[model samples]
Target chain A: MALKVIDTIYIEEEIKEHPRTIDISSKFKDARVLTIGKFGELFNKKSQSFRLQKRNPALILAKKAGRCVLPAPKGFGIGGHKNYYFSHMYNCLYDCSYCFLQGLYASADYVVFVNYEDFLEEIIEKSEENPSSVKTFFSGYDCDSLAFDKITGFAQYFLPRLRKIENCEFELRTKSINIEVLKSMEPIKNCIIAFSLSPDEVAKTLDKKAPNIKRRLDAMKNLTDQGWNVGLRFDPLIYSEDWDIMYSKLFDKCFEIIDNNMIHSVSFGPLRFPKAMYKKIKIDSPREKLFIGPFEMNNGTVAYKNDLEKQMSDFCQDQLSRKIGKEKIFHCVSDVV
Target chain B: MEYSYSIRFVVALEAEAEPIIEDYGLKRIHEINLFKVYRNNLANYWLIVSGIGSINAATASIFLYQYSNANKSSFWFNIGIAGYFTGPAGEIFLVDKILDEVTCQTHFPRSALTKKIKRDELLTVSKPREPLSTSHLIDMEGFSFFDVVNRFAVRELITVLKVVSDFPSYGYTKITKNIARNLISNILPDLREFVAEAEEISHKELIRLRNPASYNEVISKTEFTQTQSKILEKLVRDWEEVFPERYLIKEIDGLKKSSEILRKLSSDLNNFRIDWL
Candidate 1:
């Protein structure tokens, strides 16, 4: 439903004269321009509606002030103590039904911070805190790593600069199949290109506006063939009739073209939502079948009933065990702090 | 359950609606209350010329929606002339923000369709008052149009396109029926594209919701209350989406009576895991 039409751009007055802002404004010559004091005034305001704004979202370009890199959430990283995450942009191009982003923010518009260098500088500072040892930082937690690469050029600009800081590892977590920028350049050993996946049925029905599963797996095969470290993320495992065999075939298809040795890590997460977020999403989309299900409130979070949750988690775990070793498999749950 | 209509244009003035009606080749199909309703079913476009003020705009929109039995897929747009604090007499704007002077309430209109036009906030006032804000535009019926239409549909499908008629530089006397009609005519080509895009979205949305007569029969047999009926409608549609091949009678071998039907249907669908997915 949406094209690259950010006709009305709200640029922070401070960043109006910045090089990145100038470069972006040059791209949308026909877009109406407006100035604001800071992005928070527009982004964090309470009166905005996310569902309505998503239809025709405007672009908000601003400078990143204060801290750029913060520690990642406890259960967010994979086997790393000094895990950190930075959002050069907030919000993703793809619209997944189970994405936490929908409930996390009041607006759906993409907030592209024009200050990438500052985020890198802070990452460099954080990495130096424990120099000579390896630390991990993840991008695309707040936004997709490469979905908007054609427009944002995120990996194209960051991958080369990240190579300079050799001590730290970076993970570009995304569901996007756009690997042209990554294919153009040599693969970095420390950077693991993770692809988020779901079964074909789920991806086709639930992952609206996202690349097809076949195309995504094909892209992963291409990337892995180029000797890049590829990670598979089956996060937020959606439950439907015959989901076990669906995910089984999905995994079988993945391992068909993707080499097992080249696989860096594979993780799966259960479908869940916060209590308030569930309410908000329910109210916003009353016809959403996914939300209107037999969900139980567990510790202020709304999720599938305990038995169904166990069945889904255990089934996925059992399927992965048959094809891959346990060392590389991780299940992300909130209690792992 | 049967609506497949397109853009519903709500204008406060007859002159502002005339050029649009002429350009779109709209025919005076019927009348709702005292408001003249123009329709172009081939293009799936509808127009209602609300007389004046927020009450009229709100009343006209409510009337049009009720008269046609429209659904959420139908888009409602308020196209009219407004006075701006600055800018030329013919400048056009998409009302991204609207404020009601009396209620002190604000509404923001969002659109996904791309067009080559500028956007700004507008204020709805009681009288022809001077503009207090430098960047915002002043109007008589924008906030009510936005407020009422949003109640009928999602905010994204509701739009407001205003023409600059009486700016500070241009005197109020310069405003005329001919000028208002001309200003709306100037933007018809772009508005046509915008309306077409909205229609495409409505078509897609309606496809997901369009159910077969048999499903409706089963839903009605459940004898759900008014509130329950709406909820059941969503549930049935969602079930159809995921398990398109599953049939009620074929799956459940021996189901009789309404209560048993509801129990068996919900039990089997809910308890069973969709492994194919």
Candidate 2:
């Protein structure tokens, strides 16, 4: 309860119009109250008037309206193909060095748009719009889906909606130790709770503010016990001095709590970034070692040397295929133009 | 006048808060040094669980207060399981007062605006200990729990409720490893409803601060003189001269913009607000 908070304050107006505003706050029991205003809702406009001022710590509030929902990005699917993604919240709580948010956002403040119904409504409408028999809507794309469970009540509100959507499958991606949102309700059959995993050493060194491997595994065990369709994402695999040994052990540790059959799918990709994003992140925090990794600009993207990427992907593919049948594994390619 | 209901809950990590996270449905939305964002719901009420400790509890509470959007009748209840001195296992108690044992300061939630519930004495300490500190319950997160809720001017909206599962008290091992799924499921719904009602009443009692009017009224204020305001305004203008958002945007806009790249990126950055930190 004694969080070393930098500051606290309040905001008023505009945020009231959000559909999911009902669930955006539950996490900070006692946070420093900062300024609360209604005018900061438009992301683009807010950016034009932005200034980086250091405050102890404050939660900013802004109300948003219209276009409350979006289709999942293309090429963002898993398993049987159809995929769409959406995020209710932007940015995240942790400040990991390699996080895209650092380069993506100009401010470190946390903003939770109090709107959930609109997201659900959009999902329901979009699913109806697609007319496809098999379709999936992905959450947690812009932020960890469950990381703010206590704040947004995402699962509490969305799970019931998904249960109603006969052809819609929902995926929640996260690296958090929090899973009570899922445990509170019956695990939805079409819903897949995907976990992002990294080796212990990598997590310890680069993951920064995330929960350690043991805690994450413990959460996985509980989720599986609850009969949730679990997924493993070993994405943007970091190459360190002892990657092979570290990955082997990580795989073994993973198999301990997760049955390969219960897992919906396993996917991975190499560390790749849009070249401009890499440059922006470097400018934001030049000391980040990740920018200096054996990388090259291929097309507009920065990625590991082709040979290294091939070696890593090939090795992971082989090891994962041996453990889980080939059909259950997918390699997210970075060279997609 | 009635306001919307907001149930606020605070949980302490005797060992670590991770084990109980699943039970709370908290996903680490984001992580900061002292706190991480977690959101969940039990029935109609939304519950926000913070990181381990009092500062986090306070910070999370303030965040919830601003974020709640609760009207006059909104209720704020701090719902979570806690330790007790002599309470029966599975017994629930509504804390009448949260005493910060470290500071020897006391925070009492206004009982008038809340529905009368089973009341008890609860002492929050900096650290969790055995044999119960001779105070009723022992916890680490409650003091900040009282502090933050009090700031929103909704003290009555705030209530501390706990399910006693341990004694002497709930050993850290048992509390951390065991309390999940089953335990939380049983207690949360009823608590959620109770919090909703309480926050609504508390909201009615909150005194809204009046907005200041014209320059004449502003000048009538005692603390600052017209000269001071001018000086402060001049200082801010001087500072803006050195660092202007427009200038920065222009200088870096072309080199960084390139097909609206910086603009999009800056939008994301500028859209970043610290309201819900």
* Worst ten in a row by lDDT for model 2 chain A: A46-55
Write down the RMSD of candidate 2 (Cα, Å).
21.4
Strongest candidate by TM-score: 1
Among all windows of 10 consecutive residues in model 1 chain B, the one with the lowest summed lDDT is: B268-277
Q: For residues B33-148, what per-residue lDDT tens digits would candidate 2 score against the true structure?
A: 34444454432233455656787788776665556444433445555566777645666677655678889866544333233345666777776565365647666777678776
Lowest lDDT sum, 10 consecutive residues, model 2 chain B, at: B207-216
How far off is residue B89 in model 2, in Å? Answer: 53
lDDT at residue B106 of model 2 (Cα atoms) = 63
Tens digit per residue, CA lDDT, model 1, B1-277: 3545567899988899998898878888653458888887574677888988989999999988887567767877889988888767778888877789999876656665566577888999987776564888888999998777777777777889888888777755678899988888888887888888777877765654466334666765545666656545555555655566777546434654555655665665566454333
The lDDT per prediction is: 0.78, 0.59
Residue A221 local lDDT, model 1? 88
